[model samples]
Target: MLDLRLAPMAGVSNLPFRLVARECGAGLLTSEEVDARALVQGNAGTRAMLRHLPAERPLAMQLLGSEPEVLAEAARILEAEGADGVDLNMGCPVPKIVAKGHGAALMRDPLGAARALRAMRKAVGVPLTIKIRGGWDERTLNAVAIARLAEDEGVSAITVHPRTRSQQYTGRAPWEVIASVVDAVAIPVIGNGDVGSHADAAAMRTATGCAAVMIGRAALGRPWIFATDAPEREARAAIVRRHCDLIQGHLPERIALVQLKKHLAWYSTGLPGAALARPRLFQARNASEVKAVFWGLW
Candidate 1:
């Protein structure tokens, strides 16, 4: 009944990657959080990071900035470029963003983060959301406070990763805390933490009373996660073949070969010879060599 949202990992959630995840079972996929300042400068790499296949729809673009107005301007810039929706990344713990007083650093300044959310909501007519962590540390766990602010500002949704900033993606997320925030806010609450399986997806919804569950890390190389029926041998073969072909569809010959190798690991994970293939895949730098390894093994 609830949808599964894909967590945006930089260098990992590119357009080709999203397409693969979509085919697997992801209900909504977000692009890797883009740097607003870099995009404004017309950086080529930044531009490329924004690429999305036409099928990877209902895409949400996340912008990172600390200042309320600056973040608002960035949200407007993305909305005008035809983003289906926009998300503000208030939970990123990267020191670089924190150094600029952004990302999870916002947890230390809820008032400021709230004002930024208000400004961005005022600026955009599209669905606007906030992805937040519990707080800066155990001593400052204030996800409930942040959720309240998001609701007051009229945000379309709020996603809580449920770990303190100090926890930084380690340890289990505090699932019980999600109920407090859910009770406090009127918008959709996307619960994210250690959901790696469809069972986890169903459980997260029940555990937190969240409207949806979001997944990261677990999804790598495992599109079958969304459709887990212990795929048959023939189906497995077909999926691997199709995933490889999908990579080849969008990427150039050389790039596809190299990139598909990584995907091969994702597809092959937990399979009989998957561990043997990971190193071989990463070491592979071309398509023909990758095909040789895969086809030779297959």
Candidate 2:
């Protein structure tokens, strides 16, 4: 089977969405990035990111941090709470994240990242993986170096988003970089970035020889992209309904409202009259209003 999975997306890949994506055929789903220090400190908000429904099992929890001891403790906590795997976030290009020496900032300091990965690996029995960018910037395109180092540190798998921090999400993702990581590592390499459909996933696998493909942005309004076949309009509507139901049933009221608005907007993408309907979607004061507006447009 062609292995396709959902990439951990901050504010998007919570348990409800993970369940929805998995039901749609995502092979393995990852949680949004949780702050290691906050989780270790027992921060309630961070703890909430760790919540998972039984159906979302075989899920990996992704952590964002730079401290070795803190990351180690966080990994232990996640493992104790039943995470199937722990992934280090090494590719996030957000200014705040990189400024803190977390995420893609680690790409600039291989030795430090190695220490953090080593600590986390020793702290948990579960598989340790990492998601990394091509490099800190164009001149520093060192994904292969990071992949080799991660493999040596006992990281079980690597997911490469082949765009430098400087490039961010702007241009084409260099598939050749993913191919380089695969050639450099004996472990499984998962390719991410710029994949919006099954055809793109197939092309990535063919071009890079990657063991799996992870969908990030492409799956935003279309988790059905994970399904082996394109769902008909009715089936697609059913999926949106189920996703909304899960969001309401599983999330806190305040969060549920925001998620309802965000996802409904995404679901409406490309539909007739959707552009005009978006303002009303966000203007909605309650879930009922939100759904009514969205379904009215639907």
Candidate 3:
């Protein structure tokens, strides 16, 4: 089956959000990128990111780093921590990561990327996957080449976000490039980029023949996008309340309230009085205030 999976977003895809996405029917869930070096060094904040609920099984822990040794060590750590699988992040385009020869920078060195994959594959018994961009830029588009290298090094699957590092998240993702990578690899090629609705998911599959579709920014406040049934107003309010409760359970009250503000705003998206209500929603300082924002909308 071509299942919909959640894309790993740095600050957004926390345990609370992942739980919501799972309840809404996501097939697979990936943790936000955890720095391999930080994990190996035992950074508490980074280690905290590894905490997952038992329900979020079939989870893939994503690690970001350029060194094969450090990545391999981090994979071992994740395996020890009960991660179901591991994903190497080679697609991040942030300047700091790129400057350090990590993320999209690896596309410039296919051999090094392959070496890292091989080491991680050998170190862990769990399935290993790689997520990558088309290339550093249009002139160096090498996703197909890298997909082949990943398969050769024993990668279990590959995800292609069909935009170059230079393109970042701007412009339309080149679905044709994803199709090219799919044709070039025998392993499952997961297509990511520009998927916002069920129709977009279907169109991406039809156009690229990808094994699955991964939803990123689109899944933001609309976790129900993965569900089979469209939730009505009352149901939507209940879901929002549950989401706020989950956030409270997972984080401190104050921090949770701060986080809830954005989610409150997101849930208001497309609502009749969203524009009029946003100012008060953003001004909310507690869960009660946040709930009142939604309740007011009703």
Candidate 4:
């Protein structure tokens, strides 16, 4: 079966959002990228990022770092915490991450990436995966090389975003690169980047011969994209309320309210009277206020 997995976004794929995505039919929900070093250091915030509901099972926790030992230790921790799988983040293009020789910088050193993967694979007994870009830049489009390396190191799957680090989220993702990866590696290859609708998802699968399609930014507020039928306004408002309730259940009230604001903004996009509702939604001080904005929208 073709899997529809949620991408491990930085701040957006928190527990609340993953639950919502799962409810809407996502096959797999990935937690936001957690720092291996911070997790090993016992950072409360980092540890909190790993919290998951039993209902969100078949979950994958993404870990970001350049150190083999630290990543191994972190993968063990996640395995002990009941994560179904672990993913190494080699696609992030943030400057700080690259400066630390993590994320996409690992793409520049296939040997180091393989070492990290081997260490983590040895430490955990779960399915190990990797999310990577085409490469560091246009000059070094080495996803095929990295994918083959990952396969040799016992990786269970590979996700190719098909955009170079320099391209970030801009420019069209070259599906041809993803096709090359699919041809190079025997394990499951997941094609990601610019997948906004069902058609786009189908197109990516057909074009790349990938095993699955991973949705990232497109799923920000529109979790129902996983479903076959779009919900009506009343249903949409209900989903928004359910999302807020989930957030409140998982986070402290103040923090939940703040986090809900961003989701509310995303939910409001392209709706009727969105221009007027968005400002009020952003100015909301609490969950009640956020609910009011949704109520007013319908």
Query: Which sections of candidate 4 miss by over 4 Å?
Result: none
User: Each model's RMSD to truth, in Å?
Assistant: 2.2, 0.6, 1.4, 1.2
Candidate 1's residue-wise lDDT over 201-295, tens digit each? 88888888999888888877666665646567677677777777777886667767766877776666666776777677678767767767766
Q: Which prediction has the highest TM-score against the true structure?
A: 2
Preferred candidate (lDDT higher): 1 or 2: 2
lDDT of each: 0.80, 0.95, 0.90, 0.91
Instruction: In angstroms, give how far residue 289 of model 4 lies from its true place.
Output: 1.5
Clashes of each: 1, 0, 0, 0
- The ten-residue window of minimal lDDT in model 4 covers 289-298
Model 3 score (lDDT) = 0.90
Score candidate 3 by TM-score against the native. 0.96
Ranking by lDDT: 2, 4, 3, 1
How does each model score on TM-score? 0.90, 0.99, 0.96, 0.97
In angstroms, how far off is 252's CA in candidate 4? 1.7
lDDT of each residue in 1-298, candidate 2, tens digit only: 7799999999999988899999999998899999999999999989988889888889999999999999999999999999999999999999999999999999999999999999999999999999999999989999999999999999999999999999999999999999999999999999999999999999999999999999999999899999999999999999999999999998999999999999999999998999998999999999999999999988
Candidate 3: list runs displaced more than 4 Å.
none
What pairs collide in candidate 4?
none
* Candidate 4 lDDT tens digits, 112-173: 99999999999999999999999999899999999999999999999999999999989999
